[model samples]
Target: MSLRVLVVDDHPLYRDGLVTAIAAMPEIEVIGDAADGAAAVRAAKDLAPDVVVMDLHMPELNGIEATRQIVAERPATAVLVLTMLDGDDSVFAAMRAGARGYLLKGADRAEIRRALEAVAHGEVVFSSGIASRVLSFFAAGSAKSALSPFPSLTEREREILDLVARGLTNAAIAQRLVLSSKTVRNHVSNVFTKLQVAGRAEAVAQARDAGLGAP
Candidate 1:
């Protein structure tokens, strides 16, 4: 069977270019494209593609949350993160969220094709530079209880923090969660205090450092 694929990105030109390039691969089928993370999730559900080519910094849900949802709903569908971010936080967040492959935007056509094919076959793929980071992270043993990312956060606080990390403002989170604006504000405050961060920017930085998700 041809590899069914979905291309997701916020930029129209970039998304179009990606779809064209991927479609040129005779073994792959471009099932659809989405402009943002929420749309990507919805499309993935509706299309049931074999792979989702994802971009991280979208407006609504962001790629990490979308990937988490997709993998949860359809474990057989692989997520390949194609983003400009090479930082540890971005890299780790996507992997932790269940991405099967990670490639920098600068990757060549051959690399992109190979990564997609490998991921669709249940193999993990990463750009050469990113592979080293993954190895270094594991070799350092960064998986201990003492190294817990959000140590003092409550479940609710973590929920709020995740939304905030995804670029949702307090008002947006309130609307999405169907909570009062004041309630969201209070949760945000508590998250800051517990995380030892003074403000939103710091909170996002801390969350991203914990690989909570940044985009």
Candidate 2:
């Protein structure tokens, strides 16, 4: 039997492209398309689709929250996140929200199809790079806390500081973490104080020396 599918993305052209591609696959059927997270949730409930190809950065509701609600409402349906944002926060948020699969926007037709099928079969899936990121996060989580720099800050502060060390502006960090610019600024200030740094340059230098952020 063909697997029922729902495609959800803010961009009309991209959603159309996905529909066209999936239509050619004999094993999958596009049951519906939604422009945003709210509409996606409504359609998913009404269609009872086997898989939801979800985009994370939506206006009304983000994909992570949508995935959590959809999975809560229907255990049989699978959420497959397709997004451009590959930041650690975005990936972990979706995973914590119960997404079964993740793929970058540039995924090929075959990989997309495979992800839908895998999630429909109740299996977890992720793009090759995303898989490695997830694994590395887990590995880092077990490190000794006492040996870490900036022990006074919370994990969120550390994450934000790491992004800062990577040379991301507060605005850029906000976009990466799906947070408002004001919140990012607050985090940045807190990070600076905790690390005893007087300015952005000093904080960044400290963070880099501690080996934070991506390589």
Candidate 3:
């Protein structure tokens, strides 16, 4: 069966061009299109497409939050991020928000089609440049935390901190560790307190610097 897709972007020309290009693919079907994240979310609920080709910056809502909501509401649907932004913060935020694939705007139609196909099949995908960045980030973090780090934190707290640095949400961490959400939250709080950080971002920065979140 053809993969059903929803194309979303703020730019009229780019969206139309992408829709045209994707419609030409043999195994993909363009079911709908939306001009903003809010409409994208509504369309996702209404159309239930197999994959969403999402752009990061949009009016009414942003792609990251839309991806999070869509994934939460429709676990069967996948989000493929296509954006101009390639900064570490943007890439990691999309991953944390549950995007299944990421590609820069410069990616050609063939690459985009491959990404769409990959995500539709429940596989994670990224452009070569983005993949390199992700690998380098993990490698550096691995090297830094090769030995025991975060001496002040208890073993559990340290474990939680590692997951946090890996960009997992509290619920994801809880699921991975087979702990209650409340217990995960409490451990994360302790990790923050011991690390002298006020929030997850700060804690992640510190933990990654100490090599805690290696794959």
Candidate 4:
């Protein structure tokens, strides 16, 4: 089934280019396009798309604020930010505002497609450049919080979280831990519950902030 998507960006040509590229993918459908953040929010409500391709810099509302509102109003709709801003602050802002994915504007069609698909499947995705920055930021944070007081995690949970910080797949972690893939998956679920977060990325972020692992 084609995933319904809403494209929002300030530049008409850029939006057009994105539509053209996305049209080539068989599993995606561009339900509508918006020229600004307000329009994006309205169209998102009207169209009820499965995902939104949002640009960070816009004339009204802006991507981060729009994402925050859309996510708050429609928790199922995922937002993938495709923007020129790759700075640490912008990346963090987008994530904090409920974006499920972030990627540079220069990303190739495959990368964009993968991000959309991942977010649609409730997974967080990031460009390699921004991914490195986030990882390093978390690593430094983990170091600083090494002495802070927090609830103690079981040894198994810590091991699982260390693999999460390394961005390991469930199957990869299972192989390393010498457990069944299903068992590792269950452990991951338990870890998220213990951490009180929704996804792998959030769990890893919390662990890093608490000085649980190296990047």
- Cα error of candidate 1 at position 12, Å: 0.5
lDDT values, one for every candidate: 0.86, 0.84, 0.86, 0.82
Candidate 1 lDDT tens digits, 71-92:
9999999999999977665676
The list of candidate 1 runs beyond 4 A from truth reads 141-215
Question: TM-score for all predictions?
Answer: 0.71, 0.69, 0.67, 0.66
Q: On lDDT, who's better, 1 or 2?
A: 1
Worst 10 residues of 3 by lDDT: 142-151
For candidate 4, the clash count comes to 0
Q: Roughly what TM-score does model 1 have, to 2 decimal places?
A: 0.71
Candidate 2 lDDT at 27 equals 80
Worst 10 residues of 1 by lDDT: 143-152
Clashes of each: 0, 0, 1, 0
How many Å off is the CA of 111 in candidate 1?
Answer: 0.5
Question: Scored by Cα lDDT, where does model 4 land?
Answer: 0.82
User: What is candidate 2's local distance difference test score?
Assistant: 0.84
RMSD of 4: 15.4
In terms of lDDT, model 1 sits at: 0.86
